[model samples]
Target chain A: EAGVVQSPRYKIIEKKQPVAFWCNPISGHNTLYWYLQNLGQGPELLIRYENEEAVDDSQLPKDRFSAERLKGVDSTLKIQPAELGDSAVYLCASSRTVYNEQFFGPGTRLTVL
Target chain B: SQQGEEDPQALSIQEGENATMNCSYKTSINNLQWYRQNSGRGLVHLILIRSNEREKHSGRLRVTLDTSKKSSSLLITASRAADTASYFCATDSGATNKLIFGTGTLLAVQP
Candidate 1:
């Protein structure tokens, strides 16, 4: 089976611009997650969706970051007015359930100048 | 905030040698997992050990979990150059099942 897929493997934008990243989860997976990984640091969870409902998003920066999984199979994470500090790798992962092993996508590397 | 911290920010080893990495985390966890990420790539799950489990092995990878100490260790025997990557330890804690990842250890295996 194919693994999770993400679009625009790399993106570059100027500060204050809007940027969006898209993800497609593995087939039959019910849980999807978005994470942010900075240089020399591990990934940090930004949001999680169980089916179409976002079960955990406490770590997400609501003021500038928003995410949605309308069909429960695909998800999109958007950052409005991106800042210089917003430059990092955005990873998407999916699993059959919350307790199952997660499969990750290649991730989108965003650079904000 | 990151919950886990890995020992040795970086390591260099020769092929056929053994590589070990340690991870220490705060708070209780249901399970701990190890993942490997190649340069500019996504993470790949390496192994997982439950809180109650002491040791588990998969091929050349061995993982040990000590809940009492809130720590875990990963051992890769007969390491190969292909093993050169960044390794991260993540803890599954609370009802949310959120994985709190460590800072990660970058391992370079010389061919």
Candidate 2:
């Protein structure tokens, strides 16, 4: 079985620009999550989706960050007017159930100049 | 937000030595899980100890959870160079089943 997959392993854009990252969860995985990892820090949850509905998103910065999971399979996270602080690794993970361990993707490393 | 903090932020050991990492977390949790991450890569699940379970083992790794102390420890016996990586502890406490991770312990095993 395939693990969670993320696209554009690396991205670089100027501040105030828009950037997007895509994720494809493993087949049969019902829960999907997006996380941000800064240097020397652990990954922080950004948004989580149970099937097609977002069940947790309080940590997301709605001012510029937006996320969507269409059809409960793949997900997309976008940052409009990216800020320098947004420069970090965006990781995607999925699990068969909420109680199970999550499988992570290679992550999309973004650099906002 | 981070829920746990791993002690000995960095450690170095010989290839055949045992390595131990400690994690302390705040609040009540349903489970505590360990994960390993190599440089520039995704995380790999190592082990999980439920709140009800005090100890668990897998291969050369052992994890002990002390709910009363809100602390956990991961011990890798006879670790090899391949074991060189960062280890993190994540806590599951919310109804959403989300995990709150710790900063992690960076271990280097010299061959």
Candidate 3:
């Protein structure tokens, strides 16, 4: 069984530039999530998708951050005009359902200079 | 503020020794999970304990939860060099479908 997959393992962009990370969750998983982990800290949820519908996204910064799971299989997280504080690891995870254990993807490390 | 907080930010032990880490959280949760991460890669699920359950074991790993104190602990017996990594505890709060992770504990098992 293949694990969660993510692209662009590492990304470096200057402040005010835009960056986007992609994630493909495990097959047959119905719940997808996006999280941000800063240095020395744990992951914080940015958004959650239950079959292409965003069920929870309160923590996402509406002004600059956006995420979409078009078919509920793959997801994309975008940050426009990124700030230095946005530098962190972007993690994608998926579960069979809301209460199931999540499987994570190797995160995309974003560095905003 | 994170819902889960882990204690003993760092630990070091010999290969044959045991390593334990603790986690505390606020509010009620449906379940708690343990994960291991090597370097900056993805996390591997180690174990999960539901709220009603007190203790769970898998292979050489053990996890215990105390609902009254809103705390949990992970124990790895006879640790090996491959166990050198960061361990984290995540909570599944009742309201949200998301899991909030704790500040990890860095474990260095010397061979």
Index of the highest-DockQ prediction: 1
RMSD values for the candidates in order, in angstroms, are 0.8, 1.0, 1.1
Error of 2 at A49 (Å): 0.4
Q: After best superposition, candidate 2 residue B60: deviation in angstroms?
A: 0.6
Note the residue pairs that clash in candidate 2: none
Each candidate's DockQ score against the native complex?
0.84, 0.83, 0.82
Interface RMSD per candidate: 0.9, 1.1, 1.3
Scored by TM against the true chain B, the candidates give 0.97, 0.96, 0.96
> By summed lDDT, which 10 consecutive residues of candidate 3 chain B come out lowest?
B92-101
Worst 10 residues of 1 chain B by lDDT: B39-48
Task: Write down the lDDT that model 2 would get.
Answer: 0.94
Error of 3 at A47 (Å): 0.3
Looking at model 3, give its docking quality level: high
TM-score of each: 0.98, 0.98, 0.97
Tens digit of per-residue lDDT, candidate 2, span A4-111: 899999999999999999999999999999999998889999999999999999999999999999899999999998999999999999999887789999999999
> On residues A1-113, what C-alpha lDDT tens digit does candidate 1 reach at each position?
99999999999999999999999999999999999999999999999999999999999999999999998889999999899999999999999999899999999999999
lDDT of each: 0.95, 0.94, 0.92
Ten residues in sequence with the least summed lDDT for candidate 1 chain A: A66-75
Candidate 2, residue A37: the lDDT equals 96
